[model samples]
Target: MAITSANQLELLQTAEAVAREKMIDPELVIEAMEESLARAAKSRYGTEMDIRVSIDRKTGRATFTRIRTVVADEELENYQAELTVEQAKQYLSDPKIGDEIRDEVPPVEMGRIAAQSAKQVILQKVREAERDRQYEEFKDRAGTIINGVVKREEYGNVIVDIGRGEGILRRNEKIGRESYRNGDRIRCYIKDVRREARGPQIFLSRTAPEFMAELFKMEVPEIYDGIIEIKAVARDPGSRAKIAVVSYDGSIDPVGACVGMRGSRVQAVVNELQGEKIDIIPWNEDVPTFLVNALQPAEVSKVVLDEEAERIEVVVPDEQLSLAIGRRGQNVRLASQLTGLDIDIMTEEEESARRQKEFEERTQLFMDTLDLDEFFAQLLVAEGFTNLEEVAYVEVDELLVIDGVDEDTAAELQARARDHIDEMNRKALERAKELGVEQSLIDFEGLTPQMIEALAEDGVKTLEDFATCADWELAGGWTTVNGERVKDDGVLEKFDVSLGEAQDMVMTARIQLGWVDPAELESDEEAEDEDAVDTEEAGA
Candidate 1:
């Protein structure tokens, strides 16, 4: 192969033909050709020469040149490619370091070996361009649904020809044991698109919760038009799924719109999911109310939500326990996922028993701490006095509401409660001191004596130690590991220290220690507020 006038137009014609077949830009193919020609020119000229090639877009004519850069005498390592500025006076009027000097070179007449090498170079460039094009086309398509043809099955993974590229559907990402044959048309969620050394990998998933939501988007006009938004979705692959939706329009019911007329829209999605049962529920801002809706078909006797723990306890009728928990706890698990909360479903009988046990425990506590008889403790528990703090610090009028409790009796109860609490605090403080707690930590306001004792037990003895602690470490929190929530115990968790209060106290300690600037914090907070307002305005 040689660059001749007769074949100049042929080069461009071949480039356009290859570009059309690969669905890539013709200029990329031309660039690849120019590079291949340059390699051939390097072989024809001295292999050490700095050969370059440029092709005219209109004329398809190839031009070859050798570039020698002028450099400092000490820096000129390549004799064929570089020359010192003092040695290049004859070729240029003035020369400087980093300046390139070019000279035209005759095009190469590539032999069989060189032609094969050039062909390989062009193919490599074309393949790279193809991969880049595929990545660019599919990267933003992630989190969307794509239609493709099943090209082949490699091991347990299915490879689909998705228009310009291939996508992989891993066996675990498939719904149930769904299998596909060659030439089968498939619809899947574009989970991810990544550029790899080999090529761009397009990962598709049929079992993703978003897949179901997308199917609904396609089937439900209201969902596609954003009249109804899918708030959350939880799926057990081909078994069962739940979708929570909210409607922006007051006239529209999100659930009804998703269900469509006579269950047509939902039926379409269900059929696509291989008969997966779906429960469409309306979205609610109230977590308890939303959970009640998410549980579906089972009546909840009561919902006890622990916002701090991100947990909810649902009490159902004895008969509804199995239904609420479903087969192998699937119902409650799905409800938990849909509401982003850990759920504990129990029968009403169990709840009653648990409440009785708690009441007995509180009654015993009051009896022991206040030196009260069983009847008096029972009276205190019945009046919602669970801890000594309430009896100690609450208004006397509130304690007087209890049956057979006069003002003098209330005063006496308060006095007993206060004495017991003071004694307990003294004991806790003494224990903390014994554990080597410092006065700085004790003097830090907001921490109760019991809290300080707990911190000391946990090896946080000084204010410095407390300041270094994370808010979550002091207030306890839930951590999600491998899709399950794990509880992290905190030193002050038993003392009823909230995360916000712990954060404030920690920041206060940091400011006191000169570790943080309060003015800087205030400015940062103001900047954040301004950014939020700007975002709201832009959104509007």
Candidate 2:
């Protein structure tokens, strides 16, 4: 069916209606019409042929014209080829070659095909204009909340009708436990505004972390007003969330302000989140304390920092262990993220056991390697040779020079000292691996392989040999060296050793060497009785 002049007017009216509905400027619609007509005319006509379309908004009249170039040669089409000056003179009195001639196509009332073409052009223009309009309207609203009605659902994503246009709430953006029905009222953060073929696309999100932050901004005046700053926020959407807050004004309580008076403020945020729990903890500069607070409902007794390990052991009561660790360790897991600490939770009993084990290990290591009796061990510490390695490695000349030895005593002590050193070195090397002492460290600081071989040439080869030496003998003897009086008391005090232990070891060494009988020492009282009778008879 051919479109008449009335049909063209009706198309113009429809364009105006769409323009009004989409909030697009009417001038843009008119420009689109002119462009579309120009395109259609160019397609129908040849490239070299010039065609133009003009519309009068006031009268709704549309006109089309065909333009041709006049040339001197017979090289053009769409007109009388190339008109000679004499031939052009027929159309115009002074027609010149190379001049353009424009002729109106019979005001062909737009036929049915042309009318349909114009209608499509106008509709496309309106749709594009509306898209641009919606894009402009919503672009500035990113990161803000908008209330919209659910318009429809497609492939599990909801289309929501915001005031100016529709926004998409993708399935992944919906709160985990919340569902929306068509026509349902929902509030979401405007995540993005995209321009598409149909119109502006406003993307709404209910699951973004910023969603919770925005709700708090609305509910907490302090945050909105910029007095309270939200440092960070982490959420397990629709279940629970943690927000770190700090207040600019020291007098204001950031957590309290966020929580509102009587829990009214935070509750509103929670309700918006569909009953998801919110923990409003005060931010602390102290990391240990802050982490303790972040794992809420868990009372921490103490925090042991293992900085090299990048972990902190949090001690809590037996009952609070689960709470501190949370279900499947979520509480501590989030707390680690929030506070940047690798947290390990332990009950008080576990911590105690760990400490006890460490102490026992150190004590056992001390006892096994130093071969000294408890009292002699204390004495070696007093004498500044606190460890077995230190005592065993001392030079005989150095020991002899220690303010207490005579030349004869020094010689006698050297043999015993050599034996002791050899024994200690042998034992140290044997136990090195079990004691966890590195071989390289032992070689570096104490006996090397060469030194051990040299000591083995002498008969001393175990810690027990070193343990038999008398403390007084080790410190030279009872005489002075280098003209200094041998202050036996001073040496004893220095080594923290008692005289009785020293005497016993001296006697034990004699017995071991078989120079004295244990029975003769025990029978000394009877020998004294016989000697007294013989002395009394001689005096008579």
lDDT of 2 at 125: 79
Winning candidate number (TM-score)? 1
User: Candidate 2 lDDT, tens digit per residue, 94-155?
Assistant: 87767756666534444567657866887787777777877887899998999999999999
- The true-structure Cα RMSD of candidate 1 reads 2.3
TM per candidate: 0.93, 0.59
**lDDT at position 503, candidate 2:** 61
What global local distance difference test value does model 1 have? 0.93
- The runs of at least 3 residues in candidate 1 whose Cα sits more than 4 Å from the true structure, single-residue gaps closed, are 68-79, 82-102
Candidate 2 Cα RMSD (Å): 27.2
lDDT of 2 at 349: 96
Per-candidate RMSD vs. true structure? 2.3, 27.2
